[model samples]
Target: MRGRFARAARLAALLVLAGTVQAAPVHASEVAHPFTVLGTPDRRDVVTWGASADRTGDAVADRSYRLVVHTSVGGGDLRIRLSNAFGDRPVTFDSVYAGLRRDGAELVHGSNRPLTFSGARSVVVPAGGVALSDPLPGRLPAATDLVISIHTPDAAGPATGHWMAMQTSYATQGDHTAQESAGAWTETTGSWTYLDAVSVRPPTGTAAVVALGDSITDGWQSTSDLDRRWPDYLARRLSTAHTRVKGVANEGISGNKVLADGAGQSALNRLRRDVLSQPGVRTVFLFEGVNDIKAHTGVTAQDLIAGYREIAQRVHAAGKCVVASTVAPFKGWSEWDPAGEAVRQEVNTYLRGSGDFDAVTDFDHILRSPYDPERMLPFFDGGDHIHPNDKGMQAMADAVDLSRLDCAGRR
Candidate 1:
C-alpha cells in the first residue's frame, strides 16, 4: 500500500509538471516572422525623405506622417519603412505607434499597439539612410490597412518627395512614453518625410497589379496623403469591389522611357526587377514610350512599336497579363516637337492595332481633348502639358474595365 501511494504521488507530480509545460505561453520572440518586398523595382529602390528647415533658428514644429501597409495574407507580423534619404543631419523620433484609423480621424477600438525596430522603440535615421522596424506584434489581416504614426521633436532638413502617391497620416505624442492619443490623428501636424517603401506578406490566392509607366503613372502632380493618384484610386476601387487582387505596385519611374535608359533604368533593363521579380505580380499595365519619342529625337514610330512588342513578349513570357496603354496627347508639352508628335501618333496607331498585348488601356481617349484631338484635355493637364492632376488620374483609373480582369486567374 505504501509503495502504491508513493507511485501515485509520483504520477500526480508528473501530471502537474505536464500541466505547467502546457500552460507555458509561446513567446513572440520564439516565432520567426518573415516579410517580402512589394511594388515594382523603382518602388523598392527609391526612398523619399521629407525635411523642413526655414532660414533662422530652425524652430521647426513637430511633424508626423502616417504609413499604411496592406498585407497579402492574414496571420503575420509587420514592419514600418522610414527614410532619411535626403537628410543633412540625423533625424530623431520621439515616439511611434501602430494602430487603425477610423473615419480618417480616430484610431479604431482595439487597434493601438507599440512597435519596435532592432529592439529599440525609437531610432535615428542617418543622412541618406533608412530604418526598418522590428516585427510588429499583431497578426495583420490580408488587404487590411495598418497605420504607423511617427512623431519627431525637431525640424528635419527640407525634404523632397514623390508628390503623386498618397501617404498615411500620423498623430503626435506629448512625451517620451509616447502616451498620446492612439485613436485619431487630429492633433498631428502634417509631414513631408519621405517614405521610400513598406514590407508585407504576399496575399494568399491573390496577385499584384504592376503599374509600369513614366511620370504620369508615378503620380507627379497629385496631392500628398490624399491617395488621389490613379494607382491609389484603383487600389481603393479594387478593395471595395471585394476583389482579392492585391495593391498596385507603382513601378513607374519618373522620366522613364521604354527604349532608352533614364530615370533609374529603361523598361527593358529593369523588366525582370520591376515586373517579373515583383512580389505577387500577375498583371502589368504598360503606359510608357512617350519619353522615348520626346527624348529620342530621331526615333521613328516603328522603333517604338518594336520596343512595345518586345516588352509585351517579355512580360508575357514571365507569366503576366500585359495591358498596353496608349500614350496620352503631348501636343502642348514644353518639349513639344511636331516630329515627336508625329511619332506619337504613329505609335498610338500601332498600340491600338497591335494584338501583342493581352489587353489594352486607352489613356489617350480618357485624357485627350475632345475639342483639340492633339492636345491633352485642359482640365486634366496640371499646367505641365505632360503630368496629369489628381482629377486626370481619377479619370484614367475610372476608364479601366475591372470586369475584364480575371482577378482569380493565375498568370
Candidate 2:
C-alpha cells in the first residue's frame, strides 16, 4: 500500500510540472491575430474609381477627376488604389488630393488634402502597373460624403475601365485650386474612371467579396473610367445594406477561359492565384464558361458543365461560398455558331437547375432581351451583343439576394 501511494504521488508531481510548462506565457509573435472580416452596412454609399488614359500623340488637357464617397462610418483612414493595368506607356500623376465636397458640387476650396505614394507626392506607374496609397487622414462620419481628386500634367492614354461594381465616381478638368469653378470650363478634358475595389480597415468580422469571371466579368466595354459593371452594382447594393463586408475584388481576366488557355490562363488554373489567394475572400461569385463554348468547336455542353462542377468543388473545399452566375446572352458573335448556342443552353440549364452551387445568380435572365429571346436587350448591349451597359450591369447586381450570404463569415 505504501509503495503504491508513493508511485501515485510521483506521477502526480510529474503531471503538475508538465502543466506548468505548458501554461508558460507565449510571445505575441507566436500567437496569430484571428482574422475577422466585418461588413460595412452604413457605408454602402461609398465607392472608388481609377483613371488610365491613352495618349496616342496629342497634348490633350491633363486628366483629372474627383471621387465622392458617402460614408456613415467615422474616424477611419481612407486608402486609394491607382492602376495602369492596360496602358501602353508609363503614366505619371502630378498630384492627388482628398477633400470635402462643397454643397455637393465640387471639392471644397480650402479642404484639399494632398496624397502620396511611398511618401512621394507623385507616382509614375508603368504600363500594366498598380500602386496603393498610404493611409490618409480623413474622418468620414455616417451620411457624410468625401471626395478624392487626382490631377495629371500630361495627356492620358486611351483607357478602359472596370465598371459594374463601383457605386459612384466623377471626372473633371483643371487643378485642385480651380476645382470650385465647376461651370467655368468649356469642355471636360481629363477622365475619371470608377473601379471595383478600395482598401478599408473595417471593424472586426468583415470579409471581402470576389467577383470571378472572364472579360464580361472584367468590365470589357462599359466605357473607360466608369464603374458601371454588374459587380459594381452589387457592391453598391451590399454597401447600402450597411453590412460589415469589406469590399469587392475584381478577379476577372480579359479573354480568360474556363477549361482551356488563352489570354491569361484557364479559370481553373488561376483559381488558386486569383480567388483563393486574395485576402479576406469569404465569398466567390463565378461567371465563366462562355468563352469555353465559343472557343472549342467540338466540345459539348456536358464538358462545360463538368468544368463548372470541378471549379465549384474546389471552392467548397476551401470552405468558401460559391455563387454561380449564368453566362450572359451572346447571340451576335461571328464565332457564336448555332451548335455553341445549344451547348450554352444546356450549360445554363444545369447551372440554374443543378444543386452544384451554394447559390445561383441568373445573369442570363437579366441581360437577355424580352422581345428577342436569343439576343440581348437593345439598350443594354454595348454594340458587341455580349457585355452589358452600365444600366444592364446594375440590373444584374440588383437581381442578387444579398441576404443569402453571411456577412460575418468573410475573414
Candidate 3:
C-alpha cells in the first residue's frame, strides 16, 4: 500500500513538472492548447495567417463565400478579422463559420463551427472599419488549410478584399455558410474576400513576422494553390526550428510601391493596418521600393531612404523590430534602366550599412547573378525577371536567420 501511494505521488509530481496538471476551469473561448516552455505555460493570441485588404469589387447581398487560408502556428480559440476598409457603406455578416478543409469546398466531418461577434451571430461592420470575431473554441494545427465560410446578408457598395490571392476560394449565392457540403459552393475565386487575418492562441512569447513587400512577396510567379511564397517557406522553417516566432503574415500587394498608392495602399499608408494591428507581431520585414524605383516616379534614393526611416521610427514607437531586405536584381524586366539600377544600388548599400534596422537580409546577394552582377540569376528568375521561381522563393526564405526574429528583450 505504501509503495502504491509513493508511485502515485511521483506521477503527480512528474505531471506538475511537465506543466500538464490542470489547476482551474477556464472558459471555452479563453482556453489554450497544452504548450509549455521552461516548465511554465504562458498563452497569448498570435496571428497564424494574414492577407492585406484593398478595394476589390462591389458587394452582393445574401452572398456566401468559402475562403480557404493556410495556418502557420497551432493553437486554440481561433479568431478572424474581417475588413471593410475600402467600403463606401456598411456590411452585415449574418452568418460565419470556420472549419478544416477536406477537399475543395468540402470541410472535415464534425469540424464546422459557428463564430460570433460579442455573443451575437450577426455583425454589422461600418465603412472603413474592421470586425474581429469572438474566438471559437478549438485547437488549430500548424500548416493546415483553414476554411472560413462567410454569409453577407445586406452587403453593398464598394467591397474590400485581397486581390491576386494566388489561392483558390469558392463563392455561391445564399447563406450556405452553415453547411459543410461543397454542393452550394460552386463558383470559384482566386481572391479572398472580406477576411484579412486569422489568429490563434499559442504560447505567450511566440511572435509573428510580417513580410511587407510587392509582387514577389505576394507569390506572383510561384505556382498557385501550392503556398510556395517566400514567407510561406519562412513559416515552415519557423514551425520546425528552435525559434519562438512561429507565425508569418504576408502583406504583399502586386505592383505596390513604398511612397505612393497604386496597386494597393503604399507601404507607408497601410503599415498600421497591415503590420502593427496584427496580433503578436514582433518584426516587420520590409522588402518594398522596387515599384517606386522602376516607375520613374522621380523618387530619389534619398526619398526612399527617408520613407524607410519613417517606417522604422513608427515601428519602433510601436515597440517592434524592423528587418529590411535589399531589393533584388530585376535587370531583364521591361522597366529596368541604368538610372533605376543606380538608385537600386544606392538603396541596397544604404540597407546594408544604415544600422537603423535591427537586421538586414541581402536578397540582392541571394538572387543576383555573380557573372552579370546586375541581373537575376537565370536559374532563379521567373519569366518576368522581377519575380522569382519556386526554387528562388525557397532560397529567399532560407536566407532569413531565425535567431534575429526574437526581439523580446531588446529595445
- Best lDDT among the predictions, by candidate number: 3
Model 1 Cα lDDT, one tens digit per residue, 23-92: 1122232122111221112222211111111111122346565544333333334445555534567677
Candidate 3: regions farther than 4 A off: 1-43
Better of 1 and 3 by lDDT: 3
Candidate 2, superposed: residue stretches over 4 Å from native: 1-75, 84-94, 100-105, 123-129, 140-147, 151-196, 214-229, 240-243, 246-280, 291-320, 332-335, 353-356, 365-395, 407-411
* C-alpha lDDT score of every prediction, in listed order: 0.58, 0.58, 0.84
lDDT of 2 by residue, 84-199 (tens): 54455666766776566664345555555665666667766655444555555434433345566676666456442333322345555656523554453233322234221344
Candidate 2 lDDT score relative to the true structure: 0.58
Every model's TM-score: 0.63, 0.60, 0.89
Worst 10 residues of 3 by lDDT: 33-42
Highest TM-score, which number?
A: 3
Clashes of 3: 0
